[model samples]
Target: MTEEDSLRETRMPSLRIMAKNTRDVMKEPILQSILEKSILTKTQLETLLIDLVIEDEFENHISYKEKASLRSKAASRSRGVSRGAFNRTLNQARKNITRCFYTMLLLAYLGLFEFTFFSPFEELATRIEGYRRIRDTLAGKTDLSSEEIESYQSAERTILSALDSLSTSLSLKSRLSRRKTGSEIESER
Candidate 1:
């Protein structure tokens, strides 16, 4: 093959398997099979595993029944899916559920706080036709009436306050692991 063709064919290795200065005794064939089948990406697979702990602890809540059903459906569909692909889909579904759960909590908090759904800016935008009316009205002018100026300011305040309250909702870091659980873990069957 030409050098260009060879270069084009090169692929990056998955980061999870990379190790430095040492090697483990086990190859983890089951995980390898999952990867080969496209059950999930390494990152997403890790998330699902981590979140599974949290999700399991939450089984007493409302969604355990629904998710169990969904998992059954996913199991049926995943029969044809490779490990990586199945992992990707499962991770996305998990992220969606996680997001929805947290979002509902945030919304409930906002409701308790009696926060306005539409801030002054949004109200103004509606009244002004989505900023167009204000833009056209003030295109040639530098000053604004009190009501006219409050719209944008109100929106900014609402968004800032909402974000400030939701700041706790965002978490980006995660702990990594080789084995998903303790050695006692076994097949469901």
Candidate 2:
């Protein structure tokens, strides 16, 4: 088999698993509610979820051939989806997710502050503080040193980005093990 073929052979199962996992996540009540409240139609939400899952799975593949094959698979799967439409939907979904998260955090912060005599919302308060610091720095209200700005950036990247990276890593590992088992069985044959 050509290298491209071999890579695809290894990656197809990964892609399938990624799609399944994405579907599972999308079926969650929280996600469903988020989708309902967002601008994305049902079809657009489905497409965006699948694309995110597949893209995350393919993000860390070491070889260009593997990446290209995966991208081709994604393109074919999303056939008839205009690049502009997909990107717009994806961006909207991201904004919606972020807005939802912030709203939740705000509610939690308010509740904790209202109910507790002491400072029970320390973690949430810290997050809010960090968010404000970043916002202020960006708005030129706070003159952050380079290191401080980097620290804020790192903190911001840790939340959503880390979750995404962790999910991708977990899914890739799961699929790789399945691929190895399949390869071993084929070799035995």
Best by TM-score: 2
Per-residue alpha-carbon lDDT of candidate 2 for residues 21-65, written as tens digits (9 for 90 to 100): 665666644346445645666655666655655666667443322
After superposition, candidate 1 runs with Cα above 4 Å error: 1-78, 112-189
Best by lDDT: 2
Cα lDDT for residue 116, candidate 1: 40
Clashes of each: 18, 0
List runs of model 2 lying over 4 Å from the truth: 1-17, 24-41, 58-80, 112-189
Looking at model 2, residue 87 earns an lDDT score of 58
